[model samples]
Each structure stands twice: as C-alpha cells, then as structure tokens.
Target: MDSAKAEGFAESLVDLINKGALAVMISIGHQTGLFDRMAELKKFTSQSLADYSGLNERYVREWLKAMAAGKIIEWSSEPAEFYFPSEHAAFLTRKHGSDNMALYTQYIQVLASVEQSILSCFYQGGGVPYSAYERFHEVMAEDSRQTILAPLLDQILPLIPDLTQKLATGIEVMDIGCGRGKSMIKLAENFPNSRFMGIDLCAEPLESAREEVRRKNLTNIQFKQADLTAFRPAGKFELITAFDAVHDQARPDLVLRTVYESLNDEGHFLMQDIDGSEHLEKNLEHPFSPLLYTISTMHCMSVSLAQGGLGLGTLWGVEMANRMLREAGFTQIRENRLPHDPMNCYFIVRK
Candidate 1:
C-alpha cells in the first residue's frame, strides 16, 4: 500500500471512532435534558449546570468534558466554564422541532443495543425480532411526529390535488402500518368530517394510539391490529396512506397489492418511502448512506427476516419501489419531495 494513502485512511478511522463516541454522548445529553437546560444558560460551571438540570453533578461533569472535547460545547480554561452555543442548540433541542438532530442521534445507541444479536445473525442464519429492541416504537413515533405529522397539513396532504378539501368534505381514509396512530389522530382532529382508521401488526403501539384517541375524545378515528400481508378491509377507502412503512414489510408486494385492492376506484394512495436507488453505485454520494444501511442491518432487515419475511432492507430505492407499485396495478404515479425532509420520497398514485 502507498504510505500516504495508508496514513490518510488511518486518520479517517480515528475520526470515525471519535465521532461514534460523540454520538453516544450526544444521545445522553439529549435524553437527560442537559442540552435544553444548558441552552437556557449563557456560561456556567458543570456543577451549576447539573444543579440547574437536577442531574448528578459528577456524571454531568463527565458528560460536559466529553462534549467540550468533541467541540460540541464551548470550553474556557480560565474559570472552568462551559457554554452551549445557541447555534449548536438550534439543532440539538427538542424545541427546534423537526430540525432536532439530537433526537435522531438516539438511534445510534438504540441500534448499538442489538450489536450482539446482529453479530449472531452474521454467523447464524436467522434474525432478531422487533420486540428485542427497546424503545424502538417510542423513537419511531417521535420520528413520525416530527417528519410526517408536523408537515401533514401544509406540505404532505397538498401533494395530491384537492386532497385536503376531499378530507374536509368527508372521506374514508386508512393509514397502513400506522405506528402509534399520531398521523391519523392529527388528521381526525383537523378534519372532523372525515373518518380515519389506522392499522398495524403490533398491538402495543395500537393500544397507545387508542389511549391517545380517548384522551383527545376523538370519535372520527379508530385503530386496529392486523397483519398487512393478508389484510382485507370490509369497506374500501377513498384514501390510503403508508408513511415509510411498505419496504420493511414481510411482503411489501402483497401489502401494496392489498392497498391497491382495498381502495375505491377513484381513491388515491399516498406513500412516503426512503429516497434511494436500487444500485449500490448510485448511493456513493448519499449523505446518510452509512447510517441508513446500519439501521437496516440492525433493525429493518432483521425484523423482517425474523418474521420469515423478505428482508427487503431500508434502501430498496426509487426504481424498485416504482416497479413494485406498477406491478401491484398502479398505472398513474407521481413522485414528490418536501423541502424539510431530504430522507424520504412521496408518491401520489391513483387507481
């Protein structure tokens, strides 16, 4: 190997290792509300920050040192003070809404929890189930709330012409793989005239969805636990939605076909999926390729395989998704993108 190239690669590896450690620290900072508390202060000592946040001072001090070393927070040697810059806090705090990168950083720890199981799957043939991962649904619900629910009314719904007006005028709508039913509940609350139903295979999140619906006193929305692979609706829907749900299914093709058949003749299907390509070469310049693939291997693909389903993986890509849609009897399809979300692509399809 060339000496120069070897040295450059060695440096890159060191940077990667440090960034990985920083990710875990960032997750802790976000979860413990340290970032939020620090954002409220201009400059303070570790003990003062811990007192303000009501956390253990020793642990807080250690985390602060890690953040300072990583250059995530400003450090001053004169009086041993630290400052969490507003500019950095903008993307780290929950108050920042969908722009919060700290929320996404939690996935690094979540995925790391399954490292042993994933390693076993490497040597063995089977995969880890969804139930194995803790707080996964919770994380996914927060992710959906920010990415989908936050933009549903102003950005997402308008993708299909006259869709909002149709919902306002009363239409039967269904959301497949509706985890926690946040989207359906939001829609039901906004458009009281329309009837909404959310279906998923997991009962835990469905129960949580029902609780939220009851808490909101929403009569227009309902939740059901059903396997999408063999789902058959008693009544067809005027609108169907699948937000980042289809690709990881045991049988995405079957699920898509069912969605096609379960819709009215004039119904519209709004699907949001990962924005990628079928070819590996095409993803060379992808911003989140490494993270996306790691998540797929650890969670998405493994869960599907555990169910004895097709491990389609997360980056099934636009070409593969379009071909599958067409095969499922969708002839008219249009792809759309939003300014806020760069990770997914939206599809407007009509039967």
Candidate 2:
C-alpha cells in the first residue's frame, strides 16, 4: 500500500478503538477533573497535568495523547497546553444542571453487558438477574426525566383525562420498569398527594434509586427489587404504568395481564414506548431519523433481545396494544399521546 494510504488506515484503526475506549477514558478524565483542569490550566503538557493533578508525568502524557486524538481535548499550538471544547463545559461536565453528564456513567458503563444479552435467553427460558431489569428503568428514568422528555411527557401526560382525575384524588400508581425512578420522582413531585411504586430487578441501581427516593424524603414513593411478572401489587392501584420496559421483559403478555389484574376496576394502565414510526423509512436528508433507528437497533433493540427481551414492540404499538389489552381482559382501551412521543400513543385500558 502507499505510505499515505497505510498511514490513513492505521489512523482510522486507532480512531475506531476510541468509540468504546472513549467512554471509559472520558469517564476517568471527567471524574479526575481532567476536563475541568484543562479548562482552568488552558494548556496541554504532561508536566502541567502531573503538577496540577499530582500524578505521574508518564501517565499524564499517555492520557493526553488519547485525549488529543479523541478530540475531547486539544493542544493549543501557541500556548503548548491542553483545553476542552468550551461549550461542553455547560452540559458534559455540569452535574447539577438539567443537562447533566451522569448519562456517561449510567449508559456507557453497561454497553458490554447489555450487548451480550442473547435473544435465545428469552426463548429458551434462561434467567436474567433481577438487576439488569432494574438497571434498564433506572437508566430509562434519566432519559424520560430529561428536560426534553419531561416537557414532552408534560404535554402528553395531561392528555389522559381519566388518569388525571384519579391523580387529583391522591390515587396510588406503579411504574413497572421505573428505571432510576425518574417517572416515579416526576409523578411524586407533580402529584404530592399521590403515592408511587417502582418495580425492577437490578439491585445495584435500586440502591441508587432508594437513596434518591429517601433524599427527596418522598413519603409516598416506594421501590421493589422483583421481576415485573412475579412482583404482585399489595392491592389494586389507581394507575399501573410501565414505560418502554414491557418489550424488554420475557413475557410482556404476562406482565400486561398482571397489570390488568392489579389495576382498580376503572384504573388505567399508562404505558409509554417509542413510536412504531421506527418502522417508517428513514429521511435521507435529515440525519437524526436514521440515527435514532440504529440506536433503536444496537443499543435498544439488540441489548433488549440479548437479555430475553422481545423486540421494541410485540404489543407496544397502537393496534397491537389494543389487541393485547383486550386479550388481557380489559373492557375498554383509549390511546393518546403523553407529550413524550408526538406519534407514540399512551394507551389507557380500563379494567
């Protein structure tokens, strides 16, 4: 091969490695305050980092090379120091802001484990740790509770006139796949009189959720480390909700049946999921649609399938959801948007 071509190939190989490696590397960099340090120091040099962070110079040198190559940090040619993307400071490093970097730790850390989950596990009846399911929602809560998700849910959530009436009377609700408890927390905050329960299998995250639950001192919020199909409610809840998790379960049919049984006579099952518009062909001109579609595959669909999860929708879409509710013994079904997905429908099934 030509020298130029060979050099380009080698450079591309290194770049490919950064896709997975960057998550961990950036996580460490972020935690060590490397990003912050670079911003403050306003230059790159192993000597500077060694002195600033009090680390060995060799380690700093190696790290900075990757950071520079990754374009997460840059070497100022004139200043001969390192710096970060100025705008990233607001969202990537800021923890308290609604736009937070916590997703780095939450989502990236599990890339391997989630990717390894096999579709056969669900079909052959292999068991998944309760923890994985728990983790799914905890992470899910972060996405849905984001400023965008919340605003969307706010627009969409209020559309359920029946559920709203029940919430006004201090009714109890359960979020079956309440990842990180974002929905539970949001519900708790919005309806102070209403009580909320979250069920998931992952213990590691429930610990985190439990802490958040207590930190909020939300007397009404409760969490359980149990499988959704087996985790029985104490009694009928005024509302039983499962967000985007029904598809990830081994038996969404069974879980839906259970939700039907656990709901009060007139209680609603408020389910939120990605719009089936994923099946809709991509808009070649707009980049985001195809991006979401692929994400729906590798990260969302692939991982869920690996972990005994059904594809994103078995009974998740409007027509299928209507069918599932009827089969599960619900007498009435209403589909509406919950402000989260404009095209996605939140189905309310009356017992």
Candidate 3:
C-alpha cells in the first residue's frame, strides 16, 4: 500500500470534515446576525454578545467556541471573551455587502435540504426536481441582492460603454430568469426613461417582484411568469441580460438562440455565468470548484435534468460559453470579469 498517499488523503478528509461543520456554523452566524453584531463589539463575553444580538446565551457560547476552534474568531481563557477580528469581519459581516464570503455559506444548508434526492439520483438515472428545492428562490434572491445588485449599477453596466446613457434616453431592456426582478428594478430606478421586462418560469419570484414594483412605484419595469422555451418577445430589444441564468436551463441552446433572435441589430446581450473550465483538470485548480460542482449536482444540473432538459451543469467554462455564443449567432463576443466577483464571468455579445 502507498502509506504516504493514504496518510495525505486521511488528513485531507479530516480537514474537509472540519470545514463542513464550520460551514454550517458560519451559516447560522450569518443568518442570525451574530456575525454582524460581533463586528460592532470590540470584545465580548458569550452572555454579553447573546444579549446584544438578542440570541440565547448558552447557544451563543457554544457557537463562539466552534468559531474559535474554526479559527474564525479570537478566543481568550481568562475571562471567556471572544473577539471578532476586523480583518476577518470584513469577509464575515454583511457590512461588506456583496463582498462578504459568508453570503455563499448559506448554500451549504440549502444544498443539504435536497441531500436525499441527490443521493437517489446517484443510484438512479433521473434527477431531483426544482419543486424539491422550496427555498431556492429565496436563497437566490438574497444572493443576487448582495452580489449582483450593488455592482449592476456602477461596475457591470459600465462595461458596455454608453449603455447606461442609452438606458437613460429610453431603450428596450429584457432580463431573462430575473429572480424577484431585483436587477431590473435597480436598473429601472436608475434609468427611468428606459422600459424593462423581466421574465422567469417561477411564479413565486414574479409575484414578489410585482409587490416590489408596486411598493417602489416603479413605472419602467414589469415582470412575467413565462417559460423561456417558447419565449417570443413582441419586438427586438435594444438590450438583453441574463444574470447567472444560462447554465441550468432545460434547453440553454434554444434559449440562447431565442436571445440572439430577440436582440435588435447592434443590440447588446450581457450574460453573467459561472467562471469555470470545461475540463475537470482545469477546474481542480479553482478554489471554489468543488462547491460549484456540488451546487450543479444538487440543484442546477438536477433541476434541468428533471425538466428533461440539457443538463450542461456548472463549470461550463469560457471555452464552451464562447462556442455556444458563436453557435447562437453572436459573432462579436467579448468576455469580462469583475475584480470583486470571482464567481461569475460576463459575456458581452453583439448581434
């Protein structure tokens, strides 16, 4: 037996197990505002922190110990005080907004909810359906608000020069798979002269989006619950966007073709998708490649397979993305990546 290889594997497995437990705890800390509260205090006892955060003292103490053991927080023995390092807080706290690492930790629990279905799919040929993921839209909404919304205005849009100005002067904009229509809402608010339409298959998110439109008195934006398969826009749009929406489609090829046809001559199609390599070997080098593949197996790929669709899965890298864009009739395709967002790659395509 190769004893050295076995020992290395054993240590790696132990580290993986530790990280799994820490992920759940971090999710708890994020959801309960414990991390946010801790960032406000310099040093605090379990009781004090629990009081400040309005959580149970006993539970808070246990959680603090776990965080300390995970090397996420500072621990002291003399007074049993815990300190949330400012440096660490930058990644942990919601104050960093979209830049927070704790944001994606919520996926650990969401993915766990469908563990049995995913396991069943492993043995069987079929896959877990979208209906099985009840909290997916909510989780996705939170994820989008944090990661996409803030940057959509200042960072993402500016990539297409004069795009914002064009919107301000009134242009047709369509966002496919616009969960809760938050992205469209943000754009509509910023560019009131532009008309916007957001389409998605899920009714729940569309309903929520309508509520937001009413609440915000947004006149330029609208949402519709429509399947992308047979989607035929009334007219060619000047701008079309799909944020983290292309990878999991039942027929992404068809959707992309439709998007190509829907754009006017010289119109722009900005698509945001996972930044990954098509090959497993290349993907192995990425830090979050494991998580990306796990998410695809559990949710993205499975849901598409459930619909009897093309399960392209995540890690459909830039090469495949560019190829697909070309096949869909986009001759001028440019890829861009944001420094702050490591998870996604932007493809700017023109008809």
Candidate 4:
C-alpha cells in the first residue's frame, strides 16, 4: 500500500519469476552436463564445447549465453568464450560438498506429477490405483535411497555400536522398500560382515536390485517382493529402515508396530520421512521438502487413495505420527536430530 512497500513488492515479484526461470536453466545445464564438462578444462569456446559434447551448436550457444546472463557463468562477449563462475564449483561441480545436482535433476519427477496436483485426493479415498501404486513405489524408493538413505546410514549407523561391531566382522541387514537396492549394495560393501535383504512390492525394481547385488558379488544382499504391512520380517533385523515409505502405508500405526516387533531388542528403527506439513511456510526454504510435499500430494497420496479411493494416505503430520507410535507402544520416540534437516524429520523409535 505504501510507496516503499510497493517498491519492495515489485522487486519480490521479479525475483519470484526470475528464480523459477533460473531453476529451469540450471536443471537443463546440469542435465546437459555443461557444468561438469566446463569444470574439467575450466574454459572453452561455444563452438569447441558443441563439438566436444556433440550437442547442437546453436542450442549450446544460446544456452551458454543464458547461463552468463543468469550469472551462472561469465561470458567474454568479444571472442564468445564462456567461463564457469564460482557458483558452479560450489553446486554444479562435485567439488561442492553437496554437489546438489541430484537435488535438482532427480526432482524432475515432481514436475511430471504437476498435472495431477489439482486432482484433490480429499474427494476420493482408500485404494491405491494400479498404475500409480506401481510407479510411486518404484520412484519413491529410488529417490529416497539415492537422496537420503546413504547419507542417513553414514550418519546414524555410527551412533549405535552394534553396527560398528558388525563392520569389524561384517553383518547382514534388511531394507524395506529397497526399490532397486542401489543403497543396499553400498551398505553391504561398507560393512563387509553385513548382508542386506531388500523387500519391495514389485518385481521390476526388485530385479534391478538383484542384478546390482549379483554384479557387485554382494553375497550379503538379496531382494524380495513383500509388503511391510503384513509381511513379517523373516528374521531378527539388526538395522531396519523405511525411508519415507512406512508413513504412507494404509495403516501406518500398524506398520510401525510391525517394525517395532521385527527388530532385535535395542536395534534401531530408522524411518526417514517428511511430516512437516504443520510448517508449510517454513517448508519452502527446503527444496526437497516442497518437492516431497508435491509428490506426497500427487503420486504418493493419489496412488494410495486410488485403490478404494481412500484418502487416508494424504500426508500425515508429526502429531499424528507421535500419537500412532505411542499407540503402537514403542518404548522410545526420539527424533534423530541430525539425520535430516528440520524439513525431513526421522522418527528413531527404539524397539
């Protein structure tokens, strides 16, 4: 309403649109591997880059200029040379501690689900649709293991001495919703004494998981098609994990109880999931949070509701989770403070 306020509002609006466009450009650049290649030699002319990467010259030329204009790179307009700016090092190149390319590129699936965001699951409820159930199961698992699980294990496993003890001699573990078992392979290798069994609903990702296991000669890992909802753990589990999967189960509280009963006494149940809808405004600050919310709404919630049209799977908040875990009768309900940033919370309930 005031002049200053109006000026600030105008700037904010411009920044909003510019940011959206910038994200698209950055994602395209990463998908095109422009930054990675550029970081290799540090500098190259547009023509040379097009030839090197075998991309269309005109498209590459325009893209490079846009990167310069977006401040992602600096352009020598005289000779048309493009040099990657420092930001690329901190994010686009692996030199940056986080790399963050996976954060951007892997999240493209959210965009794929954008069309269905308006199809409110509230009107329909129970029954995960046939197609969505399959897709959601696969995508969510792969995304979770890639983006969060390894990082989680790297952080949480050390906290419990049992894991380190096993790593000394090696041990075996089970991963729920293990999808293609990419993360499990690494976990198996990390703790040589550890073998991992990954269980999922579909045979497709499970097959891939099996292939990866065989490829690595990881005798410690295996894949199975099973539902955590009713499929009891085959044996005592040393380290059990369901990254963002268990919370969406038809009966989540029961699933938590199942996880509780399945674990060896004192073994940890690590459930990495986002239940921060209570903090919608705050969630925007964390990109993955928003992306997860979008997926939960479109694919996750939508699919869960598809079967009988039950909207029971619509994103549940922390309070409900706490209530459910309490009802399920878990002994301890400590939040894994450092497992995930605030946006993605983990319920480290001790069995």
Model-by-model lDDT, in order?
Answer: 0.92, 0.65, 0.90, 0.65
Candidate 3: C-alpha lDDT = 0.90
lDDT of 1 by residue, 27-67 (tens): 89988999999989869998999899999999999999999
Residues 177-272 of candidate 3: C-alpha lDDT, one tens digit per residue: 998888999999989999999999888889999999999999988898888978888898999999999988888888999999999998999999
Report the poorest 10 consecutive residues by lDDT, candidate 2: 278-287
Ranking by TM-score: 1, 3, 4, 2
The regions of model 4 sitting more than 4 angstroms off are: 1-14, 95-97, 113-154, 167-172, 275-292, 307-315, 339-343
Worst 10 residues of 3 by lDDT: 125-134
Against the true structure, what is each candidate's TM-score? 0.98, 0.67, 0.97, 0.81
Of models 1 and 3, which has the larger TM-score?
1
Candidate closest to the true structure, highest TM-score: 1
Question: What TM-score, to 2 decimals, does candidate 1 have?
Answer: 0.98
Model 4, C-alpha of 254: deviation from truth (Å): 2.4
The stretch of ten residues in a row with the least summed lDDT in candidate 4 is 125-134
**C-alpha displacement of 323 in model 4, angstroms?**
2.5
Model 2: per-residue Cα lDDT over 58-157, one tens digit each:
8778888887877767777676777766666555554434555535454555444544453444456343443443245555555566633445344656
Kindly report which residue stretches of model 1 are placed more than 4 angstroms away from their true locations once superposed.
none
